[model samples]
Target: MEILKLTEKNIQDEHICCAISDKKCADGYQKKKDWLKTEFKNGYNFQKVDVRGKVFIEYVPIESSWLPLVGKNFMVINCFWVSGQFKGHGNGKKLLQQCIKDSKEKGMDGIVAISSDKKRPFMTDPKFLKYQGFEIVDEAPPFFKLWGIKTNPKAEFPKIMESAKSGTCPDKKGITAYYSNTCPFTDYYTNQVLREYAEKKNIPLTINHISSKADGQKMPIPWIINSVFYKGELVSLEMKVERHLDKLI
Candidate 1:
């Protein structure tokens, strides 16, 4: 299968591999496209398989990465996925290799990605990355792990921020969420569904839209893009059903 790279010039005409046919997420999709255009200026890259499915990888230099990690001359993978039927066809390997090749050509010291200790929603599988020669460089509370494969042995390993290490939100009395345009489902759920539900239930909700890399870096949740914290505890990383939110609250 041919792998297509998304450039600023071609992003509008291409499908971002997630929420391709979901009308509800159309606004979120456009928001992500706009976000991508800005990131492209900072050396971010987005590539996906030619097939019509969620098979893609997005990465950027650690200096410009949205995640709170400290490392120099390294590439940070924001998202890497090969979903559904695309899983067992070696597409994941090829996509990873492409990142590796690109990193090397750019004189990067290594590549790093965020994962979880167990299988979790909206996070890459640590076992798969481990099998691909990545080592656990650091870990944060609530099961977030930083995995890396260093081309240079002496390169500094990446670590999660101290704020995220606790996995506890300061606001302990309501539904607090930190989100961004990175995911297409976030805006719809947070803005419309979640707000309506919270209002109906008389629950105070605080939704923080992450607008910059700095906001993401300081987020209490390791996965800042779409994380919900209820009563000071990390609840979910993806949009949840009303029943789920009720239960969490």
Candidate 2:
């Protein structure tokens, strides 16, 4: 079992035959093909796991800032899969190790994965994220956890978030703040300022921690307020924008 970078040659129709059902992954071939060209530019790490020429696993580096909240210029394992024939072969664990090795080789800080909980298999189990040393970073169920295969757990969450190159953003060319009810910075901002005013002072836009999907579906990402998002990009809004760096620092 070799965890390899997904090249244009190997990312094909059967790339994930054992990981996901043929029906589910059949449409992903083209998506992967498209991904090979666009993934790196978007500030993400995309790779596949192959067993004797059979590509069956994928690991995606996150394209967002939340991972940065983890101490080590961190990254999240966005997409991970392993073939059914290889289940319990320690392949999942091995694949993860390989990813970590690659991360260090690439000069990354460290990695965080949203893994499968103890309740189910690696793919669909919402609670499975705990197996890989990932902790619940926010109140949201599966999406807000912070993971690291070989990193510290007690480090403080960061206030200065260095954003990823790109990811899923609802707004185009404006900032999007995924504030969660559980995040302290998010709480401070929402309580103290006018919504639009924060957007103007910070640029991009501001989102209070609301019960809408627009805020964040997973972990309800309600913690950010002093962020500059240009059409969905989370950036450093301003020094005065963040309360932690402002009042606390």
**Candidate 2 TM-score to native:** 0.47
Give the per-residue lDDT digits (tens) of candidate 2, residues 1-249.
555665545555434333143343333434435544454454455455555433333343443433233244455564565545666677666766777777667656556554223333223234444556555543222223344544435444322232321333446643455443312233334334435455456544545343322333232122222243445433432312454323322
lDDT of 2: 0.43
Model 2, residue 59: C-alpha shift (Å)? 3.9
Residues 2-36 of candidate 1 have per-residue lDDT tens digits of: 99999998998899999999999999999999999
Candidate 2 to native Cα RMSD, angstroms:
13.9
Which prediction has the highest TM-score against the true structure?
1
Q: Model 2: how far is 232 from its true place, Å?
A: 21
Off by over 4 Å in 2: 12-28, 52-57, 60-72, 115-132, 141-144, 149-249
lDDT of each structure?
Answer: 0.88, 0.43
